[model samples]
Target: MPTHVVFIHGLWIHSAAWKPWQDLFEEKGYATSAPGWPGDRETVEETRANPDGLDNQGIAEICHHYADIIAGLDEKPIVVGHSFGGLIAQELLANDLVAAAVAIDPAPIKGVKVLPFAQLRSGFPVLGNPANKSRTVALTEKQFKYAFGNVLTDEESDALHAAWTIPGPGRPLFEDATANFVRNSPAAVNTHTAVRGPLLLTSGTEDHTVPESVTLAVVKLYADNTASVTDYHRYEGKGHSLTLDDGWKDVADDVLAWLAAQEL
Candidate 1:
């Protein structure tokens, strides 16, 4: 089957960060699309300039936005997403909108426990400010380092932040953090459906943003969900930026290999 791989960017960074992945996927014959968020810009500088670009957006709206992009596709695309995008991929899969998916160090969806110190620390820059609930929150170099670049060298961390970081809507982080309290939360996932297709969840060993503990909980949530197959992979010494860090190609290659094994 001919597949169009739709790459989803997570919070802060816009779709531009996925260019390398898109190029590689297309080179392998998968048509690709990377859509910007509701009001995102072309570059990190542009997004940072328009810091309020993501104001008021939450999980459901963003998921539906990607759903709209998928609906316009010629085929049911394989969704590859990282960070918040990972959660979105799971949501899209739950809606039976994708052929297959790979979620790299995905933020926890509703019902997943939030006990890790690293998870809380990683989200602190935005979560610490309640005012951020209605506005955009940008990460500081130090904060970004702790959250996404702990495993990289100082130079690499700063460069990665400069190239990919932008202000993000704090509302979704707040919503995800408190999703269990909300009735019919958008963060909810339907793991019991076979139509959702095959899923592979990968976690970086040192990812504070979405620790392996969180991913493990996500896997357990699907334990009784035998209808849709789920697989797990863990990367040692990597951080939250696993998909974009120096070892990105290995991660991308593994995603392709997993899809091949699934015969997708």
Candidate 2:
């Protein structure tokens, strides 16, 4: 049977945004699926029209949703995720639920001490309001441009915002922000002792939402864990929109090459 691969999307982007990625992976002889988060609709329009289902959803809920999906699959599959989905990818891998994982510009997991100002500014849309913890928040075009498309051209950024952005639950942001102070936080990943499959963590140098410094810090957290493979890739001048912008294919091709190197 062909190796199965699952694509997990991050906040404010519909799973449909992974269609190009799914198509490319399938052509490479892999069976792929991009499942939405627990309450996501089948398409971007539907999701944007009715985002109330996502309200109050937290990290643990999102993790379990994907875990359940993985359980139903015929075999363990590789998971590639962005943003919070990237954080979930790490959680699933740490728990041995997937064959491998690629976390692109993933949110900072627990134990990370460096919080860049850009990251804070990026998250302020939700973090600025405490009540947002139980609500769904939508990003304005300006906010989306700042957080996800800062490095892209105005035309490209506006098009992406119109095509793919959606309301995101604020709960996960709250949970991640306080993860360091909370016991058994859902945002925590087992980076220290998991002898699991190989993992690749990528970051865009100009990413405002998840700065390179943050991803670099995550790489360091896993440095002592020589028992497993942890690789880091840096894409200079790319931003948080690296997975959806016109340059997405470049990032996707690199992931394909890396997977080939791993013989996966």
State every prediction's TM-score relative to the real structure.
0.97, 0.99
| Model 2 per-residue lDDT tens digits across residues 141-198 | 9999999999988899999999998899999999999999999999999999998999
Give the Cα lDDT of each candidate: 0.86, 0.96
Give one digit per residue, the lDDT tens place, for model 1 in 207-264: 9898889999998888888777899999989998877778899898889889889987
Stretches of model 2 off by over 4 angstroms after superposition: none
> Which residue pairs clash in candidate 1?
none
Q: After superposition, how far is residue 258 of candidate 1 from its true place, in Å?
A: 0.4
Candidate 1 RMSD to the real structure: 1.2
RMSD of each: 1.2, 0.6
Task: List the pairs of residues colliding in candidate 2.
Answer: none
